[model samples]
Target: MRISFSEWTKSGSPWVWLNAGAVAISIIMVVGLLALIAVRGLGHFWPADVIQADYEENGRQRTIIGELVEREMVPAPQLRGAGIEVPEGVEAMARDLIKVGNRDFGSADFIWAMDHFITHTQRPAMLFAAERLEWGNFYGYLREVKEAGQSVGRHTGYEKTQEYLTLWAEFQQRIDRVLDIREQILSIEKKDIGSINYEIERLRLKERSLDLEQSTDTAAYAKIEARRSELNAEYEQLQQRLTDLYQQINRDTFVAEIADGREVEIAVAKIVRAFLPNDMGLAAKIIHYAEKVWEFLSDEPREANTEGGIFPAIFGTVMMVILMSVLVTPFGVIAAVYLREYAKQGFITRLIRIAVNNLAGVPSIVYGVFGLGFFVYFLGGHIDDLFFPEAKPSPTFGTGGLMWASITLALLTVPVVIVATEEGLARIPRAVREGSLALGATKFETLWKVVLPMASPAMMTGVILAIARAAGEVAPLMLVGVVKLAPSLPLDTNYPYLHLDQKFMHLGFHIYDVGFQSPNVEAARPLVYATALLLVVVIALLNFSAIAIRNHLREKYKALEM
Candidate 1:
């Protein structure tokens, strides 16, 4: 059927199609971005075959060993400008990025090599990649195993000799032993010794409080001293035990020959994991991949957050969002109820609404500055002087921490809750309120039972939006509390389990640090994507919980709306 353009416009067919196309394109772009991030991030955990190659550079030849990270064609002119001797008239050059993991020995963790100058590339089944505690990765061939500075056995790669297999078994056994010892040491330091220190600090503060009061309390002084003495005795024992564990952990050593034929002796305790990628079967690879992913999720980050897992960041992000919701809900609901229902319709009420709507549009960083000045400096300073005078000059509450960060985000997002709640209240049919009042219900009773219940879903909708924004925000958190690394979690087994004044890590800040602040750009790039995807997952989870609650409320109140 032939149709005029004017008729199509009148029918709204063109606009409808245009809107549908726009929505489809947006969905596709978002899914593509997430897929790209997932591939790049998740692929980092998969073990790749380590390549050993010979290359000639500046009239010198050397063996280069590494995992092939990326290969690309570069403009020959660009290479020449960088002082590389590219052949004339060559429009493009094939270049490869190799991650040579012996960071302590090499000047750089990654090196760029031209394919033309490279020869004799092979992925030897015996070549192993060692993930270390200090350096990033070490690629080499295991020459021998040693114990107590004496040779125990020599490595025979791929030969599967009886003695060589036994040697590998011994190495694995030692690795397991070292891992167990590491766990014990960590538990002692973080739990046992940590508790003693916390108690000692508390005792000191108690004594200081007595001094400030000028109390003639000799008995109190004696009790404090007795507790300190007990803590000191326990701490000395833990220290000696820690010293012994360190000695045991450092006892075993192994020699590995690198690409340049230099054999370096590394301690067995230093290895995070050692794997022969080429020799790994599919099942073994899958197991190894799962382990790596788990480590990334559950372990403490090391080497400036480029190498380890991000449990702290994940925990902090979730905790902050939860705390923010707790704070913003009551304040936002009360203000919204008063404005929409109780306040007389006037210019002042109208002006307050305009101000609140304007606040939602304010730049997040501006809120950060306001929080720093008002909450951290002015308000928190007064709190410290009044309550924590014994810990003088240290500025406990007068600092950026979890409490201030949560409060700051709450203030920043309260406008959202207010607007949504007011809109929900407005949508309630005037008849509903009149009907409740007609049934001999008071105004307050009508609002509490009828109006607020129906508006719960809308309040949850505001919370969902708030979480989505607050989870991804980095700038405001930096000023308020988020840090590159937090030594201890804010919530722990201390006397006061929840320490609101402590600084914390956030996934958003972790991404920023790994991407921009890292010394190793290529090594950190994968982590950046992985953390980004994790952040998305976390936000989605939070929103999903709120959504579930919202759906339940909607279902429960469906009849009320009718």
Candidate 2:
């Protein structure tokens, strides 16, 4: 039993050093990652130096101030001054600004200034200018200009409209040309088809001749057969020509139609704008998004709302999480109740505990595959057949959607809840349960009224952890509900409002789509980081809220602990 201190220290040396080194590396890696993300994300919000022409009071000369202007608010007087024709409405508005000490130049003027100032001059105005021009108001002004048949200031609204109109007119002209070419192509196809038909007729005649020649002589029959083969070769050539003509016509028509669509052009324009050398800050982007989020929640849904807004994803994620929590909480708590309160310590109980622990360790993607296979294909297929036989091939319940995703995540997180609940149940002193039983309360009542209430904080902690993990998970949702874009929100004006079978988008998935699937990767990169940061913030907020609630509950129940 007498061990030398030196030998014991030497024996324990490796584990201590290994653990210390591992912790150090982990801290370094975490700190490094935080630093990188912070620098990139926060830097995006920082003001860029914009060269703005300020008429300094001390100097008569128009000196350029290297102050920051929001990339959105710098005035583009130059672009407005371009072509020497200002719209009557814009001129009136500008004139009105002079009377009011230029205080009433709303979003239109601001946007015009922003476009021109950012594009032409090296001088930038104050960053606060970008802050003051609300995107909602700016967009509203655009709509107003459109409605009034008035031009927007600088290079934006009316300019965009003119550009679109000019492009559209050009597109129409191109379409007309393409249509003329298509007519020629169609004529060529018709000629080829007619030629093929004539050849077929000639071949039939040759076949008839061959039949007649067969009765006369073998040589005559052979000549008729050769003539039929020549006609068949001509028919094949005509058919190939017809196919080529059809394909050419289709290609021309498709190009012309795409060129004519304004929405498609705008999307392309946005992609181009993203690539240009303009620094759009994080705060500006977020503020822009906040307005969008507000609009999505408040305003009537438009066609474009079906494309990129976060409303559907936000609604779907919240609904799905709520549903999953509802389904999982009772089952997990009940399981934990039975394990900790009712079941005696035995081989079976130990095995159950081991199984629960093992389940928690399984990869979430494996669970996703299981959900797709077992829940979607096997069990869901059976249910669909039994109840929804009319929709046999494509069962609504069996499809990949929000309901299935919720169920899948619920199953994946059940073990965590169960383990946590069991631990919470164990933590309550035996005296509390015993006292309840002594007070003529039934075991079930004691378990519910005393044990469950006290254990709720722990259970909530587990739920929060589960939620944080589930919210950011892209893989499982990808197999289940997550889509690149969903046409409608899961909750809509439809009957039985919550459509569990609907596919959804998520911030995590948005990041993936913007980063990888977008046509313009360079344009989407900043958006990708912004989306990632948003997701991280959301998860943190959720977790923090849950932690706060747990702490509150703990404080409230502190007296019960003794």
Q: Which one wins on TM-score?
A: 1
Which TM-score value belongs to model 1? 0.98
Top candidate (lDDT): 1
Task: Tell me the deviation in Å of residue 482 in model 2.
Answer: 1.6
Work out the TM-score per prediction: 0.98, 0.55
- lDDT (Cα, tens digit) per residue for candidate 1, span 1-562: 9999899899999899999999999999999999999999999999988898889987889999999999999998798889889876899989999999899988999999999889789887778888888888988878788999999988746455677667767777888889999999999999999999899988988899999999998999999999899899999999999999999999999888888888899999998788789889999999999999999999999988999899999999999999999999999999999999999999999999999999999999999999999999999999999999999898889999999999999999999999999999999999999999999999999999999999999999988988988889999999989999998899999978999999999999999989999988999999999999999999999999999999999999999999
lDDT of 2 by residue, 225-280 (tens): 78767767876876676676555434421111110112111111111011001234
Off by over 4 Å in 1: 83-89, 156-162
**lDDT values for all models:** 0.92, 0.58
Model 2 poorest ten-residue lDDT run: 267-276
Give the clashing residue pairs of candidate 1, or none.
none
